[model samples]
Target: MTMLDRRALLTKAAWAALAAPAALGGCASPAPLRHDPFRLGVASGDPLPDGMVLWTRLMGAPAAGADAAPLPGAEPIAVRWEVAEDAHFRRIAQRGVATALPELAHSVHVEVRGLAPGRWYHYRFLLGDAVSPPARTRTAPAPHELPGHLRLVHASCQRWEHGHYAAWRHVCAERPDLVVFLGDYVYEYPSPPDATGLARTHTLPLARTLADWRERYALHKSDPLLQAAHACAPWLVTWDDHEVQNDYAGTHGRGEPGDFLQLRAAAWQAFYEHMPLRAGTLAASGFGQLQLYRRQPWGRLAHLHVLDTRQWRDLQACRAPDGPARAVRPSACPELLQPGRTLLGTPQERWLREGLALDANSQPVRFSVLAQQTLFAPRHYPSGVQSTDSWDGYPAARTRLLQDIADIAPRNTVLLGGDIHQNYVCNVETQVAGRTRVVASEFCGTSVTSRSGTTQDKVDAIRRLNPHVLLARCEERGYCVSDVTPQRWTATLRAVRDPLDATSDAWDLARFVVEDGRPGPQPA
Candidate 1:
């Protein structure tokens, strides 16, 4: 049988299974009683070789000020979670109870463990007599196993008002081993004033309070395509600026002079409540200061180092009128020359340096993929308008990071980034000891729904400026899928026809492969 035939068969089977009856209780139902509804469905994320975090929320009837008020007569409720080897739950591997507290907005995150590696498992939550839909998750590949292949989809920037998430449907169809959400999962700003000709129109303004953020998340979660994608695989996620506010720097709000510390605290609390993060991993700083820089290994094929760039970085400088008018010009801005500016902050930088060192010694880890947000290589505006945001604003810090990569000299270093609503492949460059050194290759995924003006023009300009950049595509919107093997790591940039359309087709716009010991991406 052909590969296309197998894919068609699998798609048919998946849709058929979705229509099948869900697990039902054998016993008779009692008198109807008030029970918290499970509206958003169950999800699992942050998978490790031995464990993963499960998530769910208790949806109650809409109340006056449901967003803020404690649920009437609220009490701590026990949420029992179980992980089983099979979908039938006959052989349970892990089980535990977590408290659903009103303080946490009735969300539950249970981290389950004591499971075997490189295996698929099913998990669910039990609240009182009701059970949630089972969620499927897989553990990281075992060390030294050298699995034949690993597939993962990377996406970001899902602005609710921009358009529909039809791209998510294609991602779900792919059935990747994992999903890495780079960031901008939610935009905190109010709907743009000129939102005409957009995909999905916004119904409200910027998110200010916790309830506002919650409602925004609820709206996005209600999308069936996104939910289907989440249900398909365990995800690893980190936040960018929009998760709190646009252009927010450190503890400061965007241009607004107020108690930023308080705002940051609120944003952090709401973020933790809505995400599928392990309870213990939640931060107490109230400022969303959790350390998310961590590494995961997939046998000997790859090691992923996920980083948080927005939380600790310095404020992005405004573009200088007298300097570069185009954002894509590398020499247009002086802030890019700042001596001490940082993207990962001090602690995260230290952690990454240490982690890269560790990967250097580990034999099983071949490719060190920095799964992060923002374009690692310098990308300026084509019109000669310098961007105050992105790595270009902090050239010294980017230089430091590239230098570190050169020092560690992993077998192959690749930076996977998302944001900017465009896809790009660039060769990362920096200067060390007065010597120009190229460190790694970077692949930036385009937006899942967000819009950009120069999606097509930027691609052409990027290629013109950097020959090392193998490909660029700005006009299209879609996600990227990576297939990793012992010999090579291949990336396919998939683009969708139109996000506003109910049905959109996805096709591979470009393909590149990084062979073992190679430092750059080559067209496949």
Candidate 2:
């Protein structure tokens, strides 16, 4: 029989078997093979009213070395995918075939389009007799339509060796319409010699080469709970430092070693292969250049401005030439106030300035959402010391962005972020025209499983100094869920009982709310 005949036959069989309601991670598991190529599972990201990108990678094994990718000179594999209007997949909304290339380690990115807006659909992939786990994805509400509500879960910093992914387990249960993941998705470090309190360990050394980065992503994605979160909803993802190296500013790394740009290219390639990023232009930077900063809308209610802080950022202030950033006293570091020092670079800053306002064919956006990595609010540490790693390092840059957001978007703005590994709900303020005012609400969320070095004493000191901070809680691992409506926006802080246990239960740490016109969160 021809290849098309085999695929046609398999399609019917796969759909027949996947018609069962329980499909996420519970499909075709009993079948045996040399190794599960769909080990990284499937994901959908950056949803629009029409569609989103569906991603999956074929891997022989996640271990470092030969099994990390397909054997030498392997031909691309033809994979079939289907999207159904119902959970049982009785009515097919969309179906197509995509080639999983060997050059990209047999990964597939299907940008399924032309779907109805503001609705959920079930999707699955079929390879030969093997059927991938069925997952769900939702399209954004149509631009002209004013949706009554929007629910999104913000998460980040799930370092592999630190703890369990129980936080993601709870995220799956939340049934959000979207998940905004802000960086540190994988740690670039090697497995520590001391297992000590580590709940997991990488089988490989530090990620440098393309193979190394690919294996690292596979290891992180190997966790079923993490896969479940991806399956639960479409995600809006942006990277932070650890995806390449710790505290890396643009192409430069800390006083460490090796060619940083090459390292960045490999890491970028692996990240693109693993993530459900929209397929488009390849930048001149080594691998395909991924344009991370863009605006996404949730109907007429909100406009999400997702920023890429690392790729285009100037090397953090007061660092040695070509070195990474460090916390320095403003008195010692004269370069800290350089007006040219930028976090989003100049081009991105211009794009953000333009993207913050109304788009070409979109309606008046009620909520202007800033989704980026790290805290947007000012942090004042005692003794005149400030971390050059956050927004505090670039006060002028921060003021520029904040002033534009305030001048254009005003009280309708909301900032969502991660990377601090702590929960901080603050009334973000900025100086514009000689007057400082709270113009946007900021919810800098905690890490998924990564541990925070911040202590309660430090939290207390920050609260004392920054009166705009409403809630500050560190030394815990969790995620945040926000519900946005025409009247108010509410956020529930979900924390896990034991991050070390796979089956650990998660509870609400706290809740905060912001009225439609108010630019700050209050205890609900």
Candidate 3:
């Protein structure tokens, strides 16, 4: 049977099973037997050449215990998994069975090894009679090998209530090697707030408990478009303000009292449960913190530096009517414009500086790509309006970051950002060695489903003020596809016709490419 057929059948079966229990007067439970398995879908993430992580959850009712817990006397069940070279399970390369217990919500995380590099493989989870759909994954390219070509798709800000995820369907069809989810994966605020913004078409009844978060994830995952995209390639994810709370800084919430430690802990736990991340166990401290910042090398073509900007950033000060002149006039908001104020914190900043130094001297690593969230270019509201939400609010910090990039002077450093619901391509210019130097290009992707009215026009106005910007597109909803090679790196902005319509099609709105020695983007 085809995948669509299988999915349809599963949907019908699930609905029937749910309704059967009520009609039978609770005499016959429609719950799957203990041995009848295949619960949650299969997923894989954090791909490495030597190995990758596999994940799955056990099946159970919403409340199998008196306390309404998922599983009461749930014993550890053994799950068997296999990775094969073919989809038919003919040549099995690696196999293993893991025990799932209640402590981890009956979820299994298997870090398998002994696999070939730069090759595709199929994997699945098995119990007694139930089997999950086959998932396809690939390993990263070797360290020094110069890959002829590399393709990647990036997207962000998927608000479930706003519209359908048709863009994800289009991206899945492209079959990218890696999928980069920038931020705002899930919103935490409840519905029906006092204030309504342009992006606030559909609001969720606030998320309070872990179950609320899980339900939200399930709703999104139920969308075939997103699931298909996840199944197509391994995903690298990061969270924005909405994932926890809007404008939350460090361990504090927006305007809540008491210690925010409890909320932070809960948010972290829920995040781990849904993502395909391997739980690393360390001595004394139990499991180590989930390290989000890291560098991935795609052969000799590019070095992708994934950054976490929200976790450690200082809160931005409100902008004045006349811009920085009036806002930082008395230095009352010095912390907001402080040179040492950081988005990646002190330690991460140091680490990134070191990584850039190494990549600048390395012969094999040609392009230095920074995958981050938010617009790096200086964006102002209009002639008189101003907001402290973007990088423009922190001029000193932005200058420092630009100076560092200029100092390194890598062959080609490109920044890919999301959040702000618009598209932009700008040149990062700064003063170096008593002379003006421009080094690197940046591409800011528009939202996948969020609303962005008049944003594109504002970006256009900013481009005119800042000549370094090559292009900007605001009035569109879509994702970006990038092609990386040794000689040049090209990025295409694909825009969807409309988000409200289910049958909307996608087309390339703009295209830009950067050569080996060039520092800025040019029309392809």
Candidate 4:
């Protein structure tokens, strides 16, 4: 060949090499492993109609780490992964290899596509001699296709020291289409070494460094119950304060004395390392930022808008930036009423407002869901105080969001959230022409296993103060399973009999339904 022709051929070869480990139906060379490397178990998340991300981490001996972070200077390994139509792998739909790099803590995220829509599929990871667990995941329906039904279990705040993972055990039995994690996947605080009567101990130092954060995620992911829930379905995840530090507002962290930005970067990178998040999300968020907000369309039945309330919000008002989380009277903190204060920063706010206007069909969705992190209503407390860590602290922002829903999706919006350790079913109202109106329904599911410190009297006082609240209960710890149909949306507030019990079962504490074209939730 001529020199010019040779140079052109070399350029094409370089491009192909850059796109290495070709996708489905392509070729890959997988490797052999000495022992099983699935101790942390398998997980899948962020499913699309044609594809989703499948994840697993290569690990050393359990004694070394959970899917231990790779040793210094470890080389990247080619790990093979497969997507099948059946659990037994008889019908292999797609198979490919992904590199587990030391820089990413040896974790592999394989984006598998070209699968059928609205169908269940089984997936696993392979390292030649050893095989990982077979996990189940499903994709969403086609954009214009109206789904027959969709069931999702939303949960949050499971602290290791607070209780056992009985809530997740119950979730596995529910067999839902999707699992929505509204944040606090792992707590940053360590359990008191001298404390007794604890269900479990974090057994590590307070997570502040990169290694510390990795170790923290390892400890949490090792739980069989948590693993089972993950293996059950694809999850939609976002972070709350506990994932990094308590009550961290944007770059401000509990008013602590340290390089907070450096600490946040480590915690967030570790979060990316462990979560089955899209790799593009990390880069898109830019340095020192991690994007966690997106929209998930459930056919024409519902539009799920997952939001991030911690990463870009204004600093907490009134309290010392390093102060504890508490309910402060509005009069004491005038900044709470500032119009510019935000919980879901402006960019996210605009994105959410636009999505609620119309779906792909150019029609209002049957159910417009704000699958977010905190209570959205005006929740007044006993002494005219509201939580500084929740939406109650950003009144103007809350008003704007509520008004946006009123003007856009209006009667079909459902607000699903968590953060406060209580079960609440309430109405989100709007002021229309000097009259009070209920525009959207709200259900705040209590924690998966976190403890609630509020007393019955205090809860009673809160109920008396806010008449719009239909139900408020705080004794039990569990999650909410939302079943959506074209006619109505139903939420079952299920509570674990005992979060500390390994074999505990959950019972439906209460059920509420919002009929289509109606704006409020009623006992079902």
TM-score, one value per model: 0.87, 0.90, 0.84, 0.92
lDDT ranking, high to low: 4, 2, 1, 3
Least well predicted 10-residue stretch by lDDT in candidate 2: 13-22
Total residue pair clashes for candidate 3: 3
Off by over 4 Å in 1: 1-36, 62-73, 192-195, 255-258, 318-335, 380-384, 431-438
Q: Per-residue alpha-carbon lDDT of model 4 for 470-497, expressed as tens digits?
A: 9998888999998899999999999999
What lDDT would candidate 1 get against the real structure? 0.73
- Per residue, candidate 3 scores C-alpha lDDT tens digits across 1-524 of 34565345334322221211112221222233543234346677777776677766665544332111243454556666888899999999877666554444556667766688788888887665567778888887877777888888889988765666889889878888888889887877564444433323333457766666655555455566776777788777777767766666554464344435445545655666667665541112221134667787776777888887766766656433222322233245554655666677788888888888878887737898888988887654446444455576666767877877887777789999988888888877777777766688888999998766565566677777767778777788899999988898899999899777656799999999988888888899
Q: Indicate which candidate wins on TM-score.
A: 4
Backbone clashes, each candidate: 13, 1, 3, 3
Task: Give candidate 4 misplaced runs (Cα > 4 Å).
Answer: 1-34, 64-73, 255-258, 284-287
| Model 4 TM | 0.92
lDDT per residue for candidate 1 within 39-97, as digits (tens), equals 66777788777877777776665556432223343554556678888999999887766
Lowest lDDT 10-residue stretch of candidate 4:
11-20
Q: How do all the candidates rank in terms of TM-score, highest first? A: 4, 2, 1, 3
